[model samples]
Target: DELQAQKAAIQRETDLADESPEAQAIQEAKSEVDSNNKTSTTHIDSEKEPSAEEIAIAQTAVKAEARNHDLANPSASGEDTKSKSETETEKLAAAAKAKKDRINNNNEVASNTKNLMQEEAIKASNNSDVPNLVTNLNQSQASD
Candidate 1:
């Protein structure tokens, strides 16, 4: 009961302090914060992707490890026929390069498309005669 009474007294003092002139400044600042939150949006940064060279190196290492493991426990090997492991590694490397090239080409195309779109947007926005052009078209249609 004593602790409850003490808490009540402390709360009353806190309420009285909040009504003071200094606390009014804090309240005004808080209002500005609330209003700013309504108008402003937070931006998130995107994650960085690995470069082509790094991806290629990692792929190469994985292919080499697989080949080494196969050679250590060869099911069949002959002079006439290159080991399946060797052939597989070559295919994987080629496939990796092709995949990388395709990705690069796609990125280039996407960048060009984005640039063209931005340029078109800029041109459209810059054309101040749009309203006049529309009005003239309307007048011509009315006459016809």
Candidate 2:
């Protein structure tokens, strides 16, 4: 009786081990691995060398993407279109023109100021009521 009871208990323990959480997790992992292997094998079997037409189509797609990128960012593309020396030359020309304009403007301002001062001096001379120091000095010197 004791041996039979021990045998029954061992059988129950073995059954419980098969139903354990660890055993279920291991079973699930093996199923996933098998599924993945089958999928990869089928994918490999189905794959073939691309046709020339397919290759051309892929190349066209790549070219179109590149063109779109260039269109989207024009400044970032074709950076070598203008040579460095050409850009420098243009900048120098602009700076020279600006300097020339500033000098011309200053000359114009000075000429205008000189003309205004001459007009004021003439007005003062014509008005006898306003005392003119130079004319008075000249008269006094002539009398002496």
* TM-score: model 2 vs. ground truth: 0.28
List TM-scores for all candidates, in order.
0.27, 0.28
- Model 1 misplaced regions, further than 4 Å: 41-144
lDDT of each: 0.79, 0.81
Residue lDDT tens for model 2, 4-111: 999999999988997999989988999999988887855554558888998999999988998877756656757647888999999999999998787667988768
Q: List the residue pairs that clash in candidate 1.
A: none
Q: What CA root-mean-square deviation does each model show from the true structure? A: 25.4, 23.0
Highest-TM-score candidate: 2
The top-ranked prediction according to lDDT is: 2
Model 1 lDDT at residue 135? 46
RMSD (CA, angstroms), candidate 1 = 25.4
Name every residue pair that clashes in candidate 2: none
lDDT of 1 by residue, 1-144 (tens): 999999999999999999999999999999999998877645333576778998999999988987876655566555646888999999999999998787668988767766777743343366655354344546667578
